[model samples]
Target: MTQAPEDAIDVDEPLAPKFVAATHDATGEQVPTRDLSELAPPARPARRWTPKRVVITPDALDHPHAHRIVERVEARGIEVERLRANRLTGVRGATERETYALAKSTMAIVVSPPSRRKLQPIAPSADWRVDLAEGCPAHCQYCYLAGSLSGPPVTRVYADLDDILGGLEPYLGQGTITSRRADRAQEGTTFEASCYTDPLALEHLTGSWTRAVEFFGQWEAPVQLRWTTKYDDVAGFVGLPHAGRTRVRFSVNCLPVSQRMEGGTSTVPDRLAGLRRLALDGYPVGLTMAPLMPLDGWREHYGHLLDLVEAAVDGVPDLDLTAELITHRFTPGSKEVLLGWYPGTRLDMDESRRTTKRGKFGSTKYVYPEDVMTEMRTWFTDELARRLPELHVLYWT
Candidate 1:
């Protein structure tokens, strides 16, 4: 439950010696049992965002990114409104629940002042956190951003990305990785962009993240742009000249967990296939196994999850594979807000069954009991090591 660094692990260098492909079964009958495309899940159908209304502030009215966002959404017949005083309004609902729902589906275009965009350290993940956006459109039942963001949680994409990328130069080569060993693949200062939002989810509407990706692709520095997404919209940025400086980590979980909690997002197989697709393009890719719940038959579920991941990147020799293990933890405020957002959610957050721990800011949270945590951590660490020996487990919490 402690919102601090947990079991930071030291994984061996990330590089598979070679892929053992099934070229032939027995008699030299020309046959390859499985192809890369066959191993992955089929093409994912597009996810249509429901942010029908977009609000642009005066500061962003003249921004190119704002214009692009307007052009894209307007092409789809979504309304675009301009805010005069830099405040969003006019999204009402019949009740509190409906109000939350309405706000979640709205988009905002605003310029993040240089002062307000001061970079902050997000240890264990990256040297610093850089946000191209400030809210996510996904409706995960155990929504972590529920109580975190102020206002009505409308997805806000910053149009001042040039200024934001211009600010990262001062913090290079001073970050703490998972460890000197597990993170040898990314030997530089890292900047995580999806701490507060999923960039891919907003990439289609606002080209801010596309610009961010291009900026990192061309920048000459010892910095890696890191971000994770549950969405599988990768075609736009996959062909960019990232130069191995940007690591795209896909957030995945067992099918049971994702289907039960994660809503309006790509399926787990689709996300895994996205990772595979990026790896094939020679970009650094990672797997983030998050909100790990010890559900009934968890072993079977996670085993299948690992099998899918193995199928995802097994043939890519010399691959840069990273995994971030995150067990589910929640705060009282987040619980209250999520309950209001999803009153019938079956997520297990019973205080009596959880252990209490305090965070760096002295905020209390409830995490799984110590015994349960041990069981999950042990099984995952051992299984990951045995199954995918070359993968680096960045951390487990």
Candidate 2:
């Protein structure tokens, strides 16, 4: 048998060993008492692109947004799969990896009620998290959803946007903030909207985020709304009466990384354009310089990115911009899922060069070596301070 490349994954091959019972006991004759035993679980299918075909549960039709989604999708001449609530599992592939891929890319409108569980606390930045959706359509190679989301991460837009937004009222003014935060503009109670999925990509489909922004715009409190996106669909949000309450942060990276690793998402320039637009529209804009991979010539590339950012937001008066720096890291399970999703990807997720550390959630994640981490932090902090003096860095994690 041929050895696969260290970074390559064969999704078609099962990761676990299969078990089969012996047909004959002792002698060459078949044993009637013996039965075949199934042991190994089925292989996980590979993720494919399938955005046109949408699957909505029958209950989803009861929601107002679901009707709009169906109309908009149908207007574009797309196919809709109206499945029974229980039959939703049929959308997921059982054997072939390609079918699994399709499931990941399919747009599934879930008209389910928001979780009744208490909102989870997200310290350092936000007080609580509200889920308008579960999965993202963007097939970024190093997506965190690979491990966090369950099987076949089809993008799901909640039908109960009104209820979800209303649930945030009691949680207002209940979040804590870092006193030393770079940007005090977001100093009060904060609610994170993009904790699970990027809302911009689905904004056209569900308009949940648009409604959320409008809700926050009319809300009179110290509370703030924050969400990050790798997309540039800001047309719907530009004219909202946000009242300086919503912080729109664009997740960005160097050109090389953005073009190579972040698949099925907007280009760096487009995201920057969105940033500029939001800033110009008097919205508190921010940047999420995330998954900062330390690739070859990384400093030069990152510096260039900052330069582009400087140019994009240059002369935008009162650009209340903030940034968060997050270096690239991944858990073992996420790496496995990402590899299965994109077996031929060129992402350098080699564990040999990484340091093992337990994340806050008790999952083991692979981060860069100490020297590399230090270099990255130092370089980014200095570069941002030098190139974009107006931008405040919220934190580096």
Candidate 3:
């Protein structure tokens, strides 16, 4: 079929832009001149974390707390970029290697609604979840966020503190079925604040956790705020009038596991020292021995870790201490993502050694074998009883 002449198209029909070209005035040669800017995605600002680079969404750029956050972060010589929310989706690498690297180190800042409802329940520790931030800056090899969140884990702090703290009022008297314990005489709503991020890692920049501790302190209701962290910056939290409403649980692993798998986290001693400090200052403290890998001689190493914990809280009379034991488990998807994120990880994720089991969330997970699980349960329970008899074991999973 013959092509229609450019100027002979019907009035209601428009000619294809690609078929028409503007003529150069001087040479009379066809030249293509079309504006494609509207069709292209908006540019995203560069994302970096340490030697920090921060990107804020346009809607949040002018927020009062956003300004304060930017000011504080910039005060430490960090670079902040203000961009629109849509621009964030365009952040990606054209090449394979660059994309992989970008997903590992990029961080962005945006305003998100505070946890107003139980989006998903965080059982065992808290019934409902609260989030001060959405990502961790720590580069732990086995970080679960690697699988849960899309792209590289970028630490994002929401700017609306008033709304976030205000949202907790409705859940004041609510309690999860397993939240109550007779040892503490505490019974009320429980909120897990560090479900997706490490508050202490962002404390210097956002001070969200500090404010949360204070918020829980003066709350009229008997609500309890709980958070866990691998970091040890407890100085700001120690003096808060938490009223035993806030439980600061420090995540500790045997030295060998931490040194091998955890990156950019506080040293074991520093964390224990911080734990001791908080306990001494009348704060309820706990220890989280997570991802309990049954490495060779794990019992000896973990036993020594228990001994260290005992020493840290040794003299703190009437310490309201608790323990959460989590064994090493991985999903197939998580295993793939984690290996991609940290190709050099020494984590023992070999599926052949793990037993397949269905998780509470309907996801499949590879857990330690039954015999090994029994041994671990026996060892840990016995160790807690023998070394730290006063400490409460919340659950073993």
Best lDDT goes to which candidate?
A: 1
Give the per-residue lDDT of model 1 (tens digit) for 1-397: 1211212311111222222222211222223333444333344444546586788899987677678777766655567787888877876688768788778888888998564588877877877888788888898998789789876777888877767778878777665562233435344778889988987787767767777766776777666788999987776654456666778999999988899899989888888877876676556789889889989999999999999988888777457889999999999999988888889999988999999999889999999999999999999999999999998887888
Model 3 C-alpha lDDT per residue in residues 1-397, reported as the tens digit of each score = 1323424422113212222112222222224334332322222221123523567788676557777777766655567776746256534578544555554454566667433333456776676788767888787888878678765555678776656787778765455533454643364678889888887777767768888887887786667788898876665564456766778889999988898888878877778776776665566778888979888998899988988887777666457899999998888888988887778888889989999999778998899999999999999999899888788888888
Q: Would you list the C-alpha lDDT of every candidate in the order shown?
A: 0.76, 0.73, 0.70
- Model 3 spans > 4 angstroms off: 1-51, 89-91, 94-104, 113-118, 178-187
For candidate 1, what is the total of clashing residue pairs? 0
Better of 2 and 3 by lDDT: 2
TM accuracy, model 3 = 0.82
Clash pairs, candidate 2, are 46-97, 47-101, 48-101
**Candidates ranked by TM-score, best first?**
1, 2, 3
Worst 10 residues of 2 by lDDT: 33-42
What TM-score does model 2 achieve against the real structure? 0.82
Give the clashing pairs for model 3. 103-152
What is the number of backbone collisions in each predicted candidate, taken in the order shown? 0, 3, 1
